[model samples]
Target: MFTTGYAANSATLQILMQKEDIAILDMGVHASVHEGCAFTNKKTFPHNNLEALEHILKMSESMYRTKLVIIDGVYSQEGDTSRAKEIYDLVKKYNAYLMIDDAHGVGVLGKTGRGALEDDGLLDKVDFITGTSSKTFGNLGGYVIANKKIASFLKFQSRQHIFSVTAPPSSAGIVKAIDLVDEEPIWKDKLWENINYLKTGLNDLGLDTGITCSAIIPVKIGDQNKMWDIGRILIENGVYTNPIMYPAVARKDARIRMTVTARHEKEHLDKTLNVFDDINKKNAYCEKNNNNYA
Candidate 1:
């Protein structure tokens, strides 16, 4: 196990992918994935653009010694899932390897919550699967699933795994959390209920929620300044949310991000919707023509 999810990704890639190899990424992957590929030749395809990904794979087929395609199970910002099945098929066609980081998908997706690969029926077929204990596992550590040979290599050779301190004792809670996902399936059901309710409410109020099929929801608020203002208003009224801007998304695609949990009650969601409705009516921020909200 690695201390942080970042280390699991960055260190592993740094060791496995060399200058002679190429790391092809879906543009929406976490920042750690990009950092990991710093020493390797890297190419990125626009998020979930199968045609674009195929083109890159076809072009670089004979150029690199090792070609690995990396994508997220569930994109953190957009909250959408990667086209895992299609990508897996494409990678196989090009004789490339596939890695999926399911940090946001574990315990929140699939029949038994095995994550996106399970949902796509590619869990056993994927070359590598990396995930964090911090998200669904409710602890602090990261792990990689690989064959015995690769696992042994990473355990011994990865600098971060070799030099860094191990995860703390409290990390044992992650095991219990994993157990609960199976024991109490009700929580996952409740989480989905909350997701649908909030997403529908926001859409009904004429707010633009980007294509999200996961727990992370982004309420698109194009203007950065307006997004900050909206974020402030929501927090002031007791609805905490993140105001995402610039580097997180496109400059014109600033948004207010919220994570829906099973613990939330209908009253909490209603209050949130009411606050958003009030904000919309007062500022007309959700309207397309009102660009200048300064």
Candidate 2:
């Protein structure tokens, strides 16, 4: 295990990438992955753009060095899932390694919370899996899951793991969360229910929710100023949410990132939807005639 999700991501890439090695990262990968690969040759493909990924992989076949592909199982910003199985095939075809940062996927997706790998039956194929202990785990560490050889290798080679120490309390909390994930199936079910309700309500209001298939949802606002103003309005209305802008996303794709949980009741969702609906009608932000915000 590692100190944090950021640490896990950074350390894994650091261990895997050598000088002259190539890292092909999906554009939506967390920044920690980018930072870890800073010393190596790296390129980013558009989110889930398999054609671009293949082109890079095909070119790298002759390099005779490590060519690693990195992607988040569920993109943190857009809440969209990557096609893990298809990517596994591509990485295998080039005799390269594949890594999944299933930070958002664990304890949320899959039957019985086995995460994205199990959800897609990819455990035998992926070389490394890293995730945060904070989400759903209510802790403050991260972990790297791999084969015995790689695990032993990273134990000494990964700088983040060697230098950082995780507190006992954080470790205990993650253990408890893991127990709950095994014991409590209803939590995931309830969370999915909330996700569906929220997405449906936002869609009915004509908000551009993007291509989300998970709990983290984005309501596209498109303009930085408008996104911030709407975010303030949400807070003023006693609804808390995050505003996406600038380098976190393209400037033209600024959005409101919302997350739903098992704890939220139907009324809570309805209240949020009502606020969005009222805002939609009053501001007409989703309409062409009111496209000034875009």
Candidate 3:
């Protein structure tokens, strides 16, 4: 299967594709995909660039026996999306399988938050779909959603699935989370509302939130030290945020990531912006410093 990874999932992908013999049409921004085949000849393409993916597939027709296209439904760092439908079509044309990691999209998109496949209306077209039980689902476990053939195969051959301990009793929580995503449309609506409000507010502040239309907002802060300092300051002010430092992202492209929730209200958004403004005043945070309070 082709996929993007983050920890547990990445390790599994690494074991699956151990050599350079197989071709992987990979998105440059997928961290796990990059690491999976550290020594393989990966055809790295622009993130969500369907045309680039198509080129890779065309090249693979002569370069390898099997072609795999890996992508993410909703990228974690950028909060941008992959054109799953388009990629699925491209893969079908090339007679290749497409694997998608829908970690950020699950429990957040689609009619019932079934993830990108459902959101893109190409659920049946995808060969494999993987995701975590965290994020909007608010649980702790990983899942691989696929056809019975793939499911049965993994149950027997996927090292991670076979050797790993049984999922915690919290698997029950995942069930509930899925139920919530299905039963409560208001949650998704509220989440989108918060995302729009926060993103707009940050843009109004002249902060470069970076190509994001999702709940994950990345405020580019070039310096790692500054990123950590801002995270501490925000926490002190009662608003916790994530500091993505170098290695995870490119060097000097550190960011204080913000995640908006369906539970957040107008006052919460207002206060978040207020804190950013207050911090900017003391630190002279500006575009020059790459300090975006987004």
Best by lDDT: 1
TM-score of each: 0.96, 0.94, 0.87
lDDT of 3: 0.73
- Residue 17 CA displacement from its true place in model 1, Å: 0.4
User: How does residue 60 of candidate 1 score in lDDT?
Assistant: 98
lDDT of 1 by residue, 90-132 (tens): 9999999999999999989999988887867899999999989
Better of 2 and 3 by TM-score: 2
Candidate 2: residue 187 Cα off by (Å)? 0.2
**Where does candidate 2 stray beyond 4 Å?**
284-294
The Cα RMSD of model 1 versus the native structure comes to 1.9
Question: 105-156, model 3: which lDDT tens digit per residue?
Answer: 8767787767767866788778767777667767666666678875666667
Q: Which has the better lDDT: candidate 1, or candidate 2?
A: 1
